[model samples]
Each structure stands twice: as structure tokens, then as C-alpha cells.
Target: MQADNVTRTFEDPMLLQRIPSAFLISAAVLVGMEVIGFLLLCEKHVYEITGFSVSESTWGEANEVPSKINDECAENAVMSNKEMTPLEALQTADFYLLWASVCCILVPQTMLSSLSKFFGLEYIRDDSFLAGITMASSVCNAVGRVIWGLLGDYLSFKVPLCCLLLVWTILLVTFPHLSGFEGSHLKALYSLWVCLMFFCLSGVFVFTPLASNALYGSRNMTINFGLVYSAFIIGGILAAVLTRIPQLHGQTFTQFTIGGMFCCVAFVLCLWLKDPKYPNKLKNLDVFFWFREYISLRCFHWSLGRYFRQCS
Candidate 1:
């Protein structure tokens, strides 16, 4: 499976053939999932419709549901003064920078998600323990969303970003050493570490939308967010390639180190980011003052509006 040289990898006929097959298989799997989900929804609707003929009261109750949903949907559909066109949002430098930051974090985050189970088994060799650990990690992911949201409200996005990247970098560096542990101790330690890593990774999803609205404006959010999220697909591709390195004559530890380096770079990028809600003059001031302003809800909105006016 080892390539003699870089040219040999490109020249390998079988490897090239497998590339297309892999892509086809992945596409088929995605399409299958969507098709199955759509069919299930259709089946449910058909059942509901059939039931209406059997019971008018049931249909009456169901009919009221759509109006409630319309009311909920109407709230989001309303246009606001702050909304920007998608094209306008795309032209900003912040858009590209934000996209790149997300791409960086997601590469390793994808790796951890896919490989953690293998890593757990490699260390402890316990199937039951791995299953339990994965379930616990899912809970950690949910807790992380709530925790990071509150952190952003209490402080600023920058503080959470810095802390997350720093911790994530450290985790990546130390992850390769987990192979040395054994038995119940290893399971306990490995589960805790992986859960914490998952917690850190969850911040990107929670922060991205909030940060997008804050920086790019809410008007073109749907299109702008869609464009920004394309970085996630790019990250998945990078992670897929990186994960293969170990099988292709590269070391897993080195691949992980590369991921940690990306986090370091992301941390540096975060430091350069200016808050759209605050004037440039206030960007470099103390974090304590930033939190003070953030804690005052009405004052914060008023200041942000003034900042927008000054920029406009």
C-alpha cells in the first residue's frame, strides 16, 4: 500500500479507480438517506389524511396545527431594517476569514468524531465501554451548546474562542499518548478526554450562526450562512485525506500535530477579529469593560446601533 514516490501515487491505476468508486458510494449513501427520510414523511402524511376520513374530530385538531406553524414561521419571515442582501455580505473580508476559521476547526473535529470509537477500542478493547462512552459524549455535546451560549452572553465571543482553541490544541497534542493507558483506568480517562474534546468542538456550530449575524447582518443570513457552511464540506474532505495518511506511510501523531497547528493558527486569527457591535476604538480595551457593556442589555443594543450608524 506504500507509494514509492509522489508521482507513483498519481500514476497508480487502482488507486485512481477507487477514488471515483468512493465518491460514487458516498453520494449514493447521502441520496439514500434523504430519499428514505422523505418517504417516511410522506407516509406519515398519508396516514394522517386517511385518518381524517375515519374521524372528523381528528382532522379538525390536525387542521389547527398548520395555522400555529404558520404563525411561528411568519415571525422569522418578516423583513427587518438590519437585513443585508446575500451579495453584499459575501463581499466583506470578514466572511472569508470566518469561513477559514471554521474550516480549520472542523478538520480535526471531524477526525475526532469519526476516530474516537476506534481510539477507545484500541486502548481499552471493550465494546460495551465504547458504546457507553459514545452515549455520554453525546450528552456532553448538548451541555456544551448551552454552556457556550451562556458564555457568549456573559462575556464576548472572542473570550470563548480563545479558550476553546487553547484547550483543543492541548487535547490534540496529548491525544496520541492515550495508548499507554490500560483497563478501567484507560476507559475512564479516555471517555473524559473525548467528551471534553467533543464539548470544545461543539462551540463552532453554536458560535458560527451567532457570529455570522453579528458580523454580516441578519438580512442575508440564509444565503450567507449557506455559503459559509460550504467550508464544512471542505473540512470533511481535508479530514478524509488526513485520516488516510496513516495507511499511506504517514504517522497518526504527525497528522494530529498538524490539526493542533491549525488550532493555533485559528487562535491567532480570532485575536485579529473586530466585534461588529463595538467601535474599533473599543476593540482593544479590557475584557472586563466589554462584559460590563454586554451585561447591560438595552445599553448594549443602543451602542451597537450607534456603531452601525458610524460605520454606515
Candidate 2:
């Protein structure tokens, strides 16, 4: 019965009904984050904590004031504070800061990804949390479109996708804490976050795209993909409104916690997703035919000529 439903659910060639409906929940959640983030920045005046900016105090002195200017005043105001300047030190200061930011991006990327992945699944409940979490998820996630395209041509879509999501959820929920860094608790927390993040983001971030492509065929692929993709943009708009109930950036941990819970529910909703009643489409492909074609492409003309020469 279960197998039959799973198989039946994957068949429809068009009008992706059931699965599309369920996926909307996730779309709503993701898009909502963007909308809310934008609104928070615009209206509430609350920053996302980037902490990446320069101070006015770092501006260089206007040396054109004249050589006759008070030497004592110049020394007191500018010379004494050799920290940095907007013009003189901006480039160097920016370079190092950019370097450090890039370092943070790669160094703990996987670990931070795991943390975001885990946190996304566990903690990112509302706009703010989702915003931060998605920001992180977007960076570490494997590009789904490519993976799905290849998989569509190769693997059994249903089983592979389902197996992946299941594995991801299990890894996320069961991930254990890491050893603290030199007795630092953050080190432990960071480790736990990365592992689960890697697993979960890989599962969802990558699979959603494959699922998208799978539902829409290559012929009308453009339009189908477009409609689905719109979810992201509209979701941003709707999310802004929906999340305003409790507010996002100004929202507390409790509200954010609830948002995370909603995300979990959304993940659960993915289970209801099905590929159009034919999850086994790849099984019917002409494997032998493709294999013959595959080999021929490698050295079709040259190999044929070589064989002909040998025979002659």
C-alpha cells in the first residue's frame, strides 16, 4: 500500500497538484525570510549585525588647513590617533577586513553551515532567524540545479531523494555536540552545527531544485521552472506580512523558536511531496542503448577507423 502510494504519487505529467501544494509551505517560509529581512532593515532600522563598517573618526586630517596651522592641535587631534583614516587607510583597512571576512567564509564554512543547517531545521522559526539561517544555508549549499539535472539523467529520483531527506533529518536531530576548542564552548557548538548543517542542507537545498526540474519537463521547462521559481520572490513579500504578527528582528527567542517549529513542520510537509506517480521513470530508460551511445561518443570515428585499418 505504501509503495503503491509512493509510486502513484510520482506520475502526473503536468499540473503538479499535490506535491506543489505541499511545497508551498516551504516556499512561503523561505521567501518570507527575505521579505521580512528587507522590511526590518527599511522600517525598524535594525541592522542584521553585519558589523562590517568604518567609523567617521577614521577619516584622515585635512592637511590643506595650512602648514602654519597649530602644530600642537594637529598632533593632538590627528597624530596622536594613528589608528586609521578614511582616505589614507581605507584601502589597506578594507583589504584586511575583506580578507578576514573571506577567511570566516571558508574556514568555518562547513562547520558554520552545519550550524545553520541544524539551526535552520531547529532554531530558525521567524523572519530574523530564517534570514540569518538562509544566508548561511545559501552559502554552503551545493547547487541543486546541476545535481538534479545529472540525477534526472541517472539515478532513481524517488528513492534517492527520499533516502537523502531521511538521512538529513536523522543526522540533524541526532548530531552530538563537538569538543570545545581549547576549552571554548563555542568550539563545541560550532562543530555540532556544521555536521548536521552539511547533512540537512545537502538533503533539502540540493533536492528541492531536482524536484523542481523533475516536475517540469525540458520542453516547457522554461515556463514550469519560472512559475515555481516565482515562489521565492513572492514568498519574500508574503513572508514579510506573515512574520509581522510577532515581528522579526525585534522578535524574541520565543517567537523565533516558534518559527523554527514551523520550519520543522514545513520539512514534514515535504514527506507528502511526490513526483507524479512514476518515481521509476529512470528505470524504463534505454540503459543498453545509452551505454552503447555513451561508448561510441568517446572515440566513435577514430576507433571505427582504427578497427577498419586493422581488418584491412
Candidate 3:
């Protein structure tokens, strides 16, 4: 009888009509919350918050700064007005390199996160304690994003990103070896490792967008960022494939070592990555140009051989 009633509920087109009062109540609650939010959270101008008044004369006076000073400030500022179109950015070597680095760095975090619960259970026998550890890692994830974003703001994105990835690599590589402690020591170390992994993982999210904005410019930021973010799909697929490896099953050391290797590659890529605003002499020595030239030479040789054969 219960199964028949469940089937009727699934098949009934008028099920919503029967629950119209519940639906209406939920909708009303949502509308009320939205109304309250709108009232409390409306946007305000800086002047409104600071109680500053700007007269026409004050505005005119502000614009009277010397052109020479403006030029000097523009030269000194780290922010660049120069921007590229999405197509133009796509053509650059930095774009693909950044994408690859993002993919490599993301794999370690994604794989560890998916297997963390299982790994934790191996060290900490209590399911409830492991759940709490997971919750703490979640909190660390949120906090780390804000902290790392601020660090990026102060140091520029690349430096902080490199540092984070370096530390994350070390942590991943050493995590398995460090799990040999007993009792409370085991739980504490396990929780700390999980939380720190999550914390370091947050920097990838913060720095990627910041780096994209800095390198690619804000002109087509959304599209360019979407292209970069597509690396996560690749990373996720790679992580899933790694997890399914029969040898890696229950083998913590081998699994994390592989993950660490990916992060190490990401670190090397980060080292190679250049700041567009302050490009160095090494910019001309990129692998991309070398590969392009190599291909061009191969094409030239093939064409020359074809011409000689035609003459013969």
C-alpha cells in the first residue's frame, strides 16, 4: 500500500497542486528574506559611508593635477591598462603553460580530497572524530582562500602561488611517512595534515584568477578565466584515473608520491611563468618559441626536398 502510494506520488501530475499551500509558504518565506536583504544590503557610495561632500569646485580642483605627475604615477604603478582580446590571449604561450600548471597543481588537491576520508579512517579509527576533522578542513579551506588572496594582493599572485605549491608538494610527499604515530598523536597529525592540505589548496583558487587578471588583463577576463578553469576538468579526470590504478589501491605512499610529482611539475611551471608587466631577458628564451622554430625548420626541410625531387 505504501509502495502504491509512492508510485502514485511519482506519477501524479497534480502532486504540486495537492501541496500548493506548502509551496506557497516556502515562496512567501523566500520573498520575505529577499525583501529584508534588499532593505539592509543595498549598495552605497563611498561618500555616503564617509560623510564626504564633493562640490563642483572640489571636483575641478582634483582634475588640476599636473600631467607630468600623472605620467610618473602611471609609470610607477604595477597595474597596467594594457589588455588583450580573448583570441590574442589564447594565442600566447603563457596561457597554455598557466593552464597546464593549474591542471598539475589541482590534481594533488583533488585526489587527496576525494580519498581523505578513507586515509583518515586508516589512521583515526573513530568515524565521528574523522568527520570532525573533515569539518575542520572545510573551515581551513574557507579561511585559507581569504588569507592567500590577501597575500597575493601584497606580494603579487605568482610569488605566493609558488610558495604555496612548494609547501603543498612537501606536505603531500611527506604525509604518508608521517602517519606512523599511535593513538592521539595519530589523530592530531592526521587532522593537521588534512587541514593544511585544504589550506594550501585554497591558494590555487585565489591565485589563478588573480594571475589571469594580471597577465591576461581584465578585457576578456571572464572568457580567459573560463579557459583556465577548464584545466580542473582535466585534473579531475586525471585524479579519478589515478585513484582507479590497482597498484595505488590501499597504497598510501605510492598514491601521494604520484600526486606530489604533479605538484612538483606545477612548481617548475610557476618558476618558468613570467610577469607580463615586468618581463625579463629570459622571456625570449621560451620553450614555445623553440618548438615553433623547430617545426618551421622541419617544414622548410620537407619543402626543399620536395622541390629537389620535382627538378630531378
Candidate 4:
């Protein structure tokens, strides 16, 4: 009788319930964690704590470099308080310039990272050493984000962005020659180059959002940053296309040289970028005007260096 009953239950069409048991458990866990987070995490306003908004703070005061504040104050003041709608930001030339710069900057990072192992095997044959190089590169990548972010805050975003691109350009162009070093020297140099490349590349992730925020206001930063970040799509496509080029295939020097050229283009774009505060500085795409301004800025930096040398 028991066996017959068991057989009848097994044969029953509706014996098993179509319950969403897994979905219910997952939903419950997600809700519980979210509730806990909501209760634990509290938002704090900088204005409430410091009795002043960040926009009201002067760069001179923040960085304690007041000597040149007079020259920069007007520009800084406008940039600090400037707010733009996402649509307005999208319509601006600065937006497209930044997008193009990011597109070019991403090329080396995408290509090098994808080809790291393959490239490293040409010099260092050991798989374990290559793995260590990757691990070291990752550590530098994390540390660099913080360092670059702080540097941007101190010196402004443009200077650091340009410097980072310049360094990456040099690294990419010269990286293929590391194979000349024999034995341990090759491995060490290769690792150093890879780590430094990663460190410099990390700034892109930090600076892009900060630049977007500085340009478009914090209120709609999400959308503005998202628009800027779309450059990665183009960058990835370019990297893929470059890798598939017949002349570039198995030609490390040519490949790196091409990547370096792209990086140099990004650096120039950064130079041409007008300060958000001084949008009227160069109107009608004035190349001569831009060149004059750049030269003057370089001279000013040189003068400052001389002054500091004399003081010391």
C-alpha cells in the first residue's frame, strides 16, 4: 500500500509546485542588504561641516600657493561656480574635444594591456614572472589613481592630464626596445615599464570624471560623465583595428610607434582645451592665438622656476 501511494504521488501531474523559490530568496537578501546600507550610511554635506561650499573656496587657500592667485583668481572663480545643463555641455566644443582626447588616450592602454603577456614572452619566457609583473602593474594602477587625483586637485586638471599623456607617449614609443636588455635586466626593465604605463593610464579614469564635474557641475555629473566616457567605445574600436593592420602584425616597434603617435595627438588636444572659466580665450579656432597663449604660459612657468631658484 505504501509503495502504491509513493508511485501515485510520483505519477501525479500537479505534485510539484512551480514556486519561484530562488528568486524569492535572492530578492529577500538584496532587500535586507539594501535596508542595512540605507540605515548605516549617512550623507554629509561639505557646506554643513565647513560652513562654506567648495565653490566658495579659493585654489590659493586650498593649496597654500597665493603668489599667483591674483592671475588665476578670476579664472578659478568662474570655473568653481560654473554650472551647466547636460544638454548645454553636450553642445559645447569643449565636450567634443575632451571626448576625442579620451578616445586617443585609451588606445595605448587597451592595446598594451591586451598584448602584455604576448609582448612580455618575447623578452621574459617565465610565466610566473609575467604574472608577478601583472600583479605589480595592478598595485601601481590603484596607487596612481589616488596620487594623480591629488595632483589634479593641487595643480589643476589640465597640467596633470597633459603631463600624464606625454609620459605615456614616451613610454609607448620606447617600450619595444626593452628587449635589448639581457637576462634579469630585461625582466626588470619590462616590469618597470609596464607598471609605469599602468600608473600613468590610471589617471585617465580619475581625471575624466573630475574634469566632467569641473566643467558641467555636480548636479548632472552622472549624465555628463557618461557622455564623456562613451569615448572608450571608439578607443576600443581603434585598438582592435590597429592590431589587425597587416603592416603592424608582429612588428612591435611599428605597433608601439603608432600608439605613441595617437597619444601625442591626445596631448596636443589637451593643450588646445580652453579653461572652462576662460572659454572666450580662443574663439573661431585661432591657431596662432592658441600658440601664442601656450608659449606665454611656458615662459611664465620658466620665470616661476627661475624665481624659485633665486629664492632657494
Model 1 residue 140 CA deviation (Å) reads 0.4
> Model 2, 107: alpha-carbon shift in Å?
27
Candidate 4 lDDT (Cα, 0 to 1): 0.80
lDDT of 1 by residue, 107-213 (tens): 77866786665555445655567778888888999999999998866454766877899999999878877778777777777887889998998887777887777
What is the clash count of model 3? 0
**Which has the greatest TM-score?**
3
lDDT of 4 by residue, 1-312 (tens): 011222322333343343456578879999999999999998885663555556546754777765556655566666667788889998886798899999998788777786665677655667678778888998999999999988877665776887899999999999988878889988888988999999998998998888888778888899999999999999989899999989777788888888889999998887776555433332444463378577879999999999999999
Error in Å for residue 291 of model 4? 4.5
lDDT of 3 by residue, 47-157 (tens): 535767899998888887655465433542545566878888888877888999999987798778866766665555576787688889889999999999788765667
Error of 1 at 282 (Å): 8.4
The estimated TM-scores of all candidates read 0.62, 0.34, 0.69, 0.68
* Model 3, runs deviating above 4 Å: 1-79, 277-312
Task: Rank candidates by TM-score, best first.
Answer: 3, 4, 1, 2
Clashes of 1: 2
Best prediction by lDDT: 4
lDDT of 2 by residue, 1-312 (tens): 011222322245454566677699889998999999987784446658776765565433444456777644444334223332222322432223222222222222233333343333333223354445455545444554455445644442444554544554444344332322333354345444553455344544344444444443344444544444444454445444544555443333433343343344444444334343222344344343345456668778889889999999
Model 1 scores a C-alpha lDDT of 0.72
